[model samples]
Target: MKIEILLDIKNRLGEGPLWDAESERLYWIDSLGCVAYRCTHDGREIRAWDLPDAIGSMAIRKDGNGAVVALRRGFHFLDFRTGDVDLIVDPEPDKPNNRLNDGKVDRRGRFIAGSMDTSEEGKNSGLYRLDPDLTLHKLDDGIIVSNGPCWSPDSKTFYFTDSWSGEIWAYDYDLETGNVSNRRTFTRLDTSTGGAADGSTVDAEGFVWNAQVYDGKLIRYAPDGTVDRVINMPVKKITSVMFGGPNLDVLYVTSMAIRHLPRFPHDPVERGALFAVRDLGVRGVPESRFGA
Candidate 1:
């Protein structure tokens, strides 16, 4: 288990690391920077496109040239070639203060993303599902700050995080119909340790790995929601994680650069860098593509 900087490029609000297995490339977003980026497995041949607005997250399209992205305004299609953005839908037309946040593609090809209150203190957002048919459905609501949307290896259990509540919730998932129910607390972060759950990913063995923001910890949880291990990150504002590289054995991490936040300082030159944890002795399932 060795961790090293993959890219030293500082991202202001880096989040949503995704692996495109087919292309052997890595994609990620600098949320506040309003940019989408892609690079080779070894961090070479990088390319980027300026987005229309702050991008929350994105999924590789089934056809593979572009992506389906959740921007601040709503869901949109991003053409990596021409830098074009086409609107998909804005589920929350009434909640002007909320923005789409962390998201991922389900095993069944539906994109599940949650919104967060920009104020960071209002439960005015909801979780949504976007099917391949281009229809949107609301799954759950009353969320303040949503993060960490991922499912178990079997795709029967869905895990999500409301950072403000400090709790990671699990729910029953129907892969066939894209329905979720029976929500319950899976694990709660001890914020007294100075962190909240940021982003998460499930391994091929069914363990959940979460990036703890402000506390600089990467926590691995067993299927039963017990802490299996913890790795202290070099930066305090670790935002997201994903398993990339050709074999999906590398854990790629994203972090934040803004220093004057609530509790973070202006130190740690690597605060906004991208990282790769190698030789973890674990592999990850291929991320499903949108509309696949």
Candidate 2:
């Protein structure tokens, strides 16, 4: 297929585009701007909220109340009605250089998030899971930039990325026990041309659609580690992707304008933008919300 530029906010660092099925709105975050935004399917009705700190990612609540947010300092609850914020847990209070990055609620409503080092690169970061009861568990360690963290349609497999390593890994997931095993390489990037995989989402057919940062494209991959399709993009740094629209035929993508500063200086069109492509007709499972 073909990709179209739907909304070009010129976002400094736009990430985490989640489709709110009940409201028919797309929610995303501008990490550097520390703002969360909501818009319609056609890219209208823009609404934004200023967060106290940089927001890594967010998820809708099970009861349709508000959202559980992973912020730079810690995790909190965002009230959709009153706009009230409540802190849940802070995993890295001592490591000031580290900040929360990408996160999502599993099938069981447990929020799993990853952290990245804001200072130096390399594997100084780790992945943590926030249970429904608000307890935190360290799932993996020695990661530099943690991204993706999306689950398969059956909830029996998890796909996550380590951007620094340029590798996407799959883990055998135990839905009941919330445990992951059998860590193996799913895919690796060609560092010469493609940027590392950032955020990703799985479709109903078990294909993983990932946003290839610096590559200016979105890739669909089969379960056995094969490239299914690639949709070219205008911008270099694509941050994330999600399947949305009425029948989920439309795919919404978020991109970053961070690393293209000096080279493409003064070029305004390619910054933080929301993109859309049609005809996939793949429905994504509703995002899990946090609640009792």
Candidate 3:
């Protein structure tokens, strides 16, 4: 249960902490800064690429050339060597107000992501699946700020959150076809308790860990959607969570620091920094790569 700051880079909107096991490196993004970052597990050899638009999330490619990113414009191929971004498609071309947000690669190597309504009021966004063939399919619609896309250890259930709704939904996942069905409410946060849902990851033991943004709580849930444990963080704007490190035992967290909090002026200076939670007594499954 030891919490320590790994990097105090002061990211404006830090999200998407991804662990690359093949290279033993970490990847993340500063959404507001329009920058993607990479570093070692110990936070060294840091490199960054300036993207044209705000990036919500990214998945490493099997070929190791770069990543398939969910940028504000749409899905694009980000080349690590040349920094060239090639657009795939804009799933929400008609809804100019919505942008791609949280996403993850399923066990079958399909990139699943959802859009978010920038206004935070409309339910015009959609959940989409990008197949290995570079084809995108719409899975669900009417979401307002999609976040925390992940699945159960057995690949039978898919979990996703619409931050504005304060509830995380579970769907029947078909690994063979990459389709989702039978949507049901898995858990609902009494925002008074843990704040809204952000990013999430499933551990090796079939537990779900989620970061609650405003309240700064990292919640671990059993497979039945019951709260198993809760860890309070030092910062309020904890944006995302992942399991990294060589052993996949270290829990990495990202946070947001968009502006000075006039209300909580005494907030810790590490609010926007990256954090590592070690000695959790648990390990995590490796994240699947896109097109792998």
Which stretches of candidate 1 lie above 4 Å from their native place? none
TM-score for all models, in order of appearance? 0.98, 0.94, 0.96
Candidate 3 residue-wise lDDT, 125-202, digit = tens:
999999999998999998999899998989999999999788888999999999999999998887875378999999
Candidate number achieving the greatest lDDT relative to the actual structure:
1
TM-score of decoy 3:
0.96
- Per-residue CA lDDT of candidate 2, range 1-292, in tens? 6678888787778999998777788899998888888888888899887888988999888777788888998898888777788898889888888989999888788888999987527678889988888888999989988999889889988999888687899999888877788999998877677467899998888899999887777889898768998877777778898888766668889877666334322324766788888766566776766653
Residue 234's lDDT within candidate 2 is 77
CA shift of 245, model 2, Å = 1.2
State each candidate's clash count.
0, 1, 0
User: Predictions ranked by TM-score, top down?
Assistant: 1, 3, 2
lDDT of 1 by residue, 7-43 (tens): 9989999899999898889999999999999999889
Clashes by residue pair, model 1: none
lDDT of every predicted structure (CA atoms): 0.91, 0.83, 0.90
Clashes of 3: 0
Error of 2 at 152 (Å): 1.5
